[model samples]
Each structure stands twice: as C-alpha cells, then as structure tokens.
Target: MTRTAILVGITMNQVNFDYSMEELANLAEANLIEPVGVITQKIDRTNKATYVGKGKVDEIKGLADYEDVDLVIFNDELSPSQIRNLEELLEIEVMDRTRLILDIFADRAKTREAQLQVQVARLKYELPRVVGQGEGMDQQSGKGGLKNRGAGETKLEMDRRRIKQQISQLNKELDSLVAERQVQRRNVRKMKSQLCPLLAIPMLESLRL
Candidate 1:
C-alpha cells in the first residue's frame, strides 16, 4: 500500500506560484507519496502563525480527512507552536515547508557527506517543540523533588545538544571535503591552461606566425 499526501500551497497570485507548487507535488510523487489534492490561497502576506489563515487551515484539514490523506504538506515554513496546534486539530501528520524539502533532499543525497548534512539539519529543525518537551516545562517547574530539579532540560534540549555536536563534527568533515575539491579544481585548471598554450603554438604555426 502507498501513502498519499496533499500539497497545500497559498500564494498571492496563483499564476505566479503555481509552477513551484506543481514542482513540489512532483517531488512528492517521486518519493512515492501521491499528491492527490492541492489547496491554493491568494493572500496579501502569509499568516505568521499559521502560514495559511485559520479558515484555510480548517478547509485543508477537511480536505485531508475527506481525501483520506496521510499528510498535509504546507508550502511555507511554520512555527513550532503552529505545527503543534495543527497536529492537535487535524489529528494527522503536519509537514511544513523546510521539513518537506529536506525530506526530498534526503531522498536523493546519495553521497555520504550530503546525507550527513541533511540529517544534521533535519534533527536541528525537529528538536524544538517536540512532544512532551515544550509541554512539560511548566509542569516540571511545579514539582519539588530532585527528579524534577533540572527537569526543565527537556528531551528536546538533550536532542538539540546532541544535534549541535554532530553538526559541528559534520561541518569539519564537509570543510575538509570542500578544500579537497578546490585543490582538484585547481589541478584541472592548470592542466587545461598548459594544454591551451601547446595547442596555440600549433595554431600560430598553421597561420605561419
């Protein structure tokens, strides 16, 4: 069985943003998730909280339920609180702009370095507003025991710290690889320049220089 997804794109002009949204839908299809429906909105500016307006959210939610979709993919990045709210109301997986694109990137990151970078970025984005971490802060503050002490360090915090460390290490490795590529490029350029001078000598002779 295949999972179905829907692309919900909201833009000021349907003509202006339609192609990008369509491309995204294609990417979803390539990943084996069927993008069976689309919801477009012409808005002045995207809502900061919801990206799409509240009414549109409800509309999309209903569409997802009616379509029996596994996920609703938004075209813009959403706040952590917004994701939480939408998940609570929709009772389905909610993926925002960045996460959706990163998922696409991860799928095609055939190189080890590229794969590592994608994972680091994904975890960094996902660590915040994770379930139980943000919600338990207030509850933990009220408890008066050693177990509760430093309990404000939520699971998200632990994951965030671990992600940061991994990112740092990956950055160092990527940097080394980048430097190696630069040297390779330099070598190729040098060989091409040397060959060009030799080729020019024969051409100049052919012209009786």
Candidate 2:
C-alpha cells in the first residue's frame, strides 16, 4: 500500500528552497510515499525543539489530520529531540530528508554487501536518536509498513554498546566479502593470463594457413 505523507520545509531566505522541497517530494515518491500536503515556513531560524515554529507545527498537525497522512517528511535533517518533539506534537510519524534517503538506499540494495553497508549506516544514524528515548523508540520504531524506515524495536532495545558492536560486526562482514571478491578476481585474471598464450597459438596457426 502507498503510504501518504505531509512534506514540511523551512526557507531561511534561500533561493533553492523550492528545488529542495520538490526533490524531497520525489524522494518520498521513490519510497512509495504519496505527498498529500506541503507546509513551508520562512523563518530566520528553526525552533530548537520542533525544527519548525510553534504555529507551523500546529498547522502541520491540522493538515496531517485532514489529509490522514501516515507520516511527515522534513526537508532537512532533524535532531533527535526535534524528531521526538515533532512526533509528540503532531501525533504522527516524523522523518527527515536523511532518513528518507537512507530508506530509499536500503530498499533498493540488492547485494549482501550493499545491504550490510546500509544497515551499518542506519545503525550509526539511529544511535544518538535512540539514546534517551528508549521507551518511545519501542513504541514507534518499525511500527509502520515503510520498509527500512527504522532499525526495528529489537535494535532500539539494545544499548549504545550493543549497537556499536553490531556496526563493528557488519563492517567485518563487509571486509570479508571484499577480500573474497578480491581473491576471485585474482584467480580470474590468472586464468585469463594462462589462456591468452593458447589463444595466440590458434590465431597464429590460422594466419599461417
């Protein structure tokens, strides 16, 4: 099923705001999220807690309810506190541009190596966000149908040390895959080198004939 979302952006008098928001919508579409509404704020700075002004947050909440959106996508990378605060205020799932991009890569990743790398990147991103929000994380993480949006509640249950251990393990597996591929490539090159001489003899015989 296609998940619907509300796109939120802030323009600090930047010229590329429109382009950035449009790209965010495309990214959302790539992840099978239909953008039902857009809310923009032109602020000198973002609210420290919610990333948007208080009034804008309320507006987003109203729009989210009206559109029945499953999530809200922010144009910029939000701090962990900002994410938590916005979700609490809006009573909906909240995600940032960084999270959207990560999810896209995770879903499209085909090979084991690529999958491992994406997982590692995701864990690193989730680490700080999950620090003091363990209880909340359990309630929200991986609660939806969006694939690869969160690291799953089980991982969120893990302490920082455990998450780091997982990241280390994933890196090791990636390294092993790289080494295995290197060996296979070397063997292929060696076999090709040996076969070239025999191939040259056949060509020489044909030339003589």
Candidate 3:
C-alpha cells in the first residue's frame, strides 16, 4: 500500500540540503510512501521544540491538511519530545529520517541475522522515547492522581524493561552467530593446512624436469 507523505527539511547553511531532501524522497519511495509535497525552512538553526520555526510548522500543518497527506517526514532526526510536539501541532503522523531508514531496513531484512540486528537497533532507538508515554494522560487524570501516576510509572517501567531484555537477547543471539562463524572459519583453515602437503606434491612433480 502506498501512503502519501510530505517531506520537511530545515536548511541551516547546508550546501547539500537539496540533495538530502531528494534522498529523503527516495527513502520514502523505498518504504512504499508517495511524497506529495516538500516543505523547507531557511533558518540559522532548527527549533528545539518543533524542529522547525513556529510559522513554518503552521504552514506545514495547513499544507498537510490541504494535501491530505497520511504523514509528514522530516529530513533530520528528531528527538522524542520534538516528534510529540510536531504530531500534536500537525495532527498527523510524524517521522524522522532515522526511523524512516530503519523501517526500510526492517522491511528488506530477509535473514534472521539481519532481522535481529534491525530489531536491536530499533529497540535502542525506542528506549528513550518510552519513558514519557503517559505525560498527557497523567495531566488529564486530575481526580485519580496517585492511581494514574502509579499505573503510568509501572507501565513505563515495564516497557523499558521489556525493550532492554529484547536488546540483550538479540545481542546474545548475534554473539552466538559470530562464534559459530568463527568456528567454521577455523575448520576451513585447518582443512587448508592439511591439504598444503598434497598441493606441494603436484608442484614437486611438475618441477621434476
């Protein structure tokens, strides 16, 4: 299925801004996303809270609403807070380049090793973002303050623990794969060593003249 997306980029003295945005479009295409439009901001630096200027964000939000894009993709990596902020303002799905590339890698990963690696990378990327899951919900639960806080904390802790466990497990599996490959390489070297004498016999016979 093809999802429509809008590309957003901030040009802060970057000579290759155009190239990077083009690559971002290509990446979106690779992920089965159709880039319907591009929005760029020429700023001295990116806004910490929203990634782009407030005015630009408003324009982007209007453009996204007008175009009816499924999501908006940023050319640069965004902090968890930044993503949340943008999604709140835009009222649409928001993604950054790192997540976008990871998605592509995950989709194209066919082998077990490749899949495990991708999973590990994704877990690492998501670990920090899990800590603030219920910020809004906590604020909204004015009456059941203590209960809501406790539940949110417990859930957040559980998520962190789960992601950590998965990352550890994936690392162990990868280590085992590495060890197996090393053993196979050693066995091949041993076989080559054993065959060296036979190979020399042929050379010796050829030099009999």
Candidate 3 residue 206 C-alpha distance from true site, Å: 7.1
Tens digits of per-residue lDDT, candidate 3, 1-209, equal 89999999988889998999999999999999999999988888778999888899999999999999999999999999999899999999999999999999999999888998999999999998775554444443244666565434445666788899999999999999889889999999999999999899999999995
In candidate 1, what are the lDDT values of residues 55-164, reduced to their tens digit?
A: 98899888999999999888777888888777777889988778877888898899877987898788778767455554344433446545676645555556667767
lDDT of 2 at 154: 45
RMSD score of candidate 2 (Å)? 8.5
Q: lDDT winner between 1 and 3, please give it.
A: 3
TM-score of each: 0.72, 0.86, 0.85
Higher-TM-score candidate among 1 and 2? Answer: 2
lDDT of 3 at 9: 90
Ranking by TM-score: 2, 3, 1
Scored by lDDT, model 1 comes in at 0.79
Query: Order of all candidates by lDDT, from best down to worst?
Result: 2, 3, 1
Residue pairs that clash (backbone atoms under 3 angstroms), model 2 = none
Candidate 3 lDDT: 0.89
